[model samples]
Target: MKIIADLHTHTIASTHAYNTILEMVHYAAQAGLKAIALTDHGRRMPGAPGDWYFQNLATVPRRLEGVLVLRGIEMNIIDYEGNTDLEENAKNLDWAVASIHGGLMDPNVKPTVELCTELWLKVAQNPMVRVIGHSGTPQFAYDYEKVIPEFGRQGKLVEINEHSFLVRKSSVPNCKKIAEVCKKYGVPIVVDSDAHFCTELGVYPNAERMLKEIDFPEELIVNGDENRLYEYLRKYTKVLEEE
Candidate 1:
């Protein structure tokens, strides 16, 4: 399946990430992608951009270098209760990806299957969440059978993050299992670069191989087709409202 849009990525504003927003968008355009989401890290992440950075995202044009730019934030999930470090001006953004990052969670809230499952269930119900970003980390594994369906029911796209293969190697096996469970439940998903640098933008060889090995259905991947992605954004996000 061809992913016409990459729905998760990072820029220099995220500190550890190495590219600027325009650089990332330019790479997407050159890669022939129809769209890309510039999702910088949330405030709680060490060195993450200030609140003004997200609030001022309105100044970014909806389209850049012929590629649709989704103004988004990767809000860190901070507790077992599914609370996120969501900015107060979240309404100003076009997309939000809820993720559990190491070291950002509450110290008292341990990672148990039940707790993680509950966390994801609550995240699924959050109106601000569009993507359930990279939930297959071994430390934060949830009940795939229960939560995958709930994610679909809530219109949240489960992510198959390519970056995990590089940085979170131990999670790869679980990620494949998660994808298999998603396929079994007919849960729609998105494959993202989760790119921290310009060169990583729109790159998905590892993700594609895994999905193909599982014989994943093309239609169930929301960003696999340009129209399918546009349809989703129109329904769940205001990004297309002015287009």
Candidate 2:
């Protein structure tokens, strides 16, 4: 199976991520990817771009260097109630990937499976969320049986993030389990680079390997075919009308 689109990535605007938006897009084009999402970090992360940054994303061309560019955010889910750093003014973003991060949850508050499961159920109902990004961090494991089906019902693509393998190795085991559960429930999924640098754009060897090992069904992966991805964007996101 091939991933024609990579719907989660970071740029220099995220503060710690190393590449510029154009650099990442260029790499996506070079890698021969049909589409890519430039999802910088949302507010709440220290030094993350302000609301103005996301609000001004309309200025970015819908297509860049022959690659479809999705102007979006990897929004940090801030509480057990599933609140995120997404500002009202930034709601027009073409795509969104909700994620759990350090600053959002209190360090002393243990990440119990029950609490995390509750959190994600709320996220699944959010209209602004199109993808559930990298949610299998060992600390933030959720109740897969209950949530995976809801994710499918809500059209939220569960992400298999490549960066987790290299930077957050602890997530690997749960990621496989999540993929397995997603398959079991016929939940749609996306494989993303979650790339912090230009060189990593469109790279998904680790994520691909996990799915191949599980003999994951190609049709369930949103990015497995260009038309499948385009069909998803048309139904669930505000992308694809870009000229």
Candidate 3:
């Protein structure tokens, strides 16, 4: 499938990210992407945008350089209870990506993979979470069987982050497992560059290769079509409004 929308990206507003919204838009357009989401790091991260920044996202154009722009957050899962640091602002965004950011998740002395998986399952079940980003990271290990099936039932997407696979060596094996489980459960998967700069946007050839290697079905990749993406965005926006 030809993936056209990259739903996980970061802007300069996210501490370590190096791009601006305008720069991302330009790069996405040049790369022929139909849409992109600006999912800055959670408020807990140093130098992350403040509440006002997210609340004022309306000022940003929905369409920039002929590409749809989605305002979102990569919220940190702060506790085993599945609480996120940006709970108050989460419901107001265009999309929400609930993730385990290492520092935020409290293992509570257990620190077992099963315990972490259980916590993530709780986060996935939350209506506010639209996507579970970078689940393949060993640092925040989770059972794909339990998580993927439930995520599918809840209409949430599971991410195959390119950067995670590139930076975290252990992510390769886990990502393969994630793909297999997602396929088995008929869960939709989103491949993202997890790009922090404009030049990196929509650059997922490596991820595409991995998906192909796993023999993952094309239809399961959510970013494969623009029409479906717009439809999902509409539904997602409605959910945010009701929150």
Candidate 4:
């Protein structure tokens, strides 16, 4: 189960992440990846890049280091209402991954399973959202039976983020559960490194392991097939048309 493109990765523009865009692209090229997304954290996260950084992504050529570079943002989901911190200007990016981060949510709100389910359902309907990032964290488990199907209907890729195993191990059980439901519903999924550094680009051992365990259908994995990924990009984004 090899992925030709990693659709969620971070660069030094994300502050906490350690390498530059070129550096990350270099690693992707080295890994023989066909494409990679530079999805920096949105402004709501502490030290996250500002609007200018994301809005000006046009300057970063679509092709870099012999790899297709997807300019994107990992926006922070801010409330149970499913409002994200994505800047208006960054809305047109080639890709977007909306996720709940412990540090960025409303401090006053306590997330219940029902509330998280509602939030994700709303996010699923969001046209701007391309990928549902690392959902069903231990603390943010939603109603998988209901929401996963909606995600499928909305054409949102449910991410099986490899980074969760390394940094958010507590979410592993829920991640497996999400994958099971995804397979049952025949929902398309994306496997991403969610890397914070160049060295981590195209790394997906954990996500691949989980998918293999459940015998998840390979054709349903967008990043696993280059032509399928290009078709998806051309369908929902201006990527191919940009030429």
**Per-residue lDDT value at 233 in model 2:** 85
lDDT per model vs. reference: 0.91, 0.90, 0.82, 0.90
Residue 47 accuracy (lDDT) in model 3: 84
Q: Please, what are the lDDT tens digits per residue for candidate 4 over residues 132-241?
A: 99995888889999999999999999999999999899999999999999999999999999998788878888888888998999999999989999999988899878
Q: Write out the backbone clash pairs for model 1.
A: none
Better of 2 and 3 by lDDT: 2
Question: What is the per-residue lDDT of model 2 for residues 1-243, given as tens digits with 9 covering 90 to 100?
Answer: 778888999899998999888888899999989998889988888879999999999999998899998989999999999999899998999899999985568788888999999999999999999999998898898999999999999889999999999988999999999999999999999999998888887788899988999999999999989989989988877676655
- Give residue 234's lDDT in candidate 4 (0 to 100): 87
Q: What are the TM-scores, per candidate, against the unseen true structure?
A: 0.98, 0.97, 0.93, 0.98
Off by over 4 Å in 4: none
Which parts of model 3 are misplaced by more than 4 Å? 107-110, 239-243
Error of 3 at 233 (Å): 2.3
Query: Per-prediction count of colliding residue pairs?
Result: 0, 0, 0, 0
Could you tell which candidate, 3 or 4, scores higher by lDDT?
A: 4
* lDDT string, candidate 3, 1-243, tens digits: 777988999998987998889998999999999888889988887788888888888788788888888888898888777788875755667888888777655545545678777887788778878888887777667777777898988889999888876776688888888989999888988888889888888888778888999899988888888767766766656622332
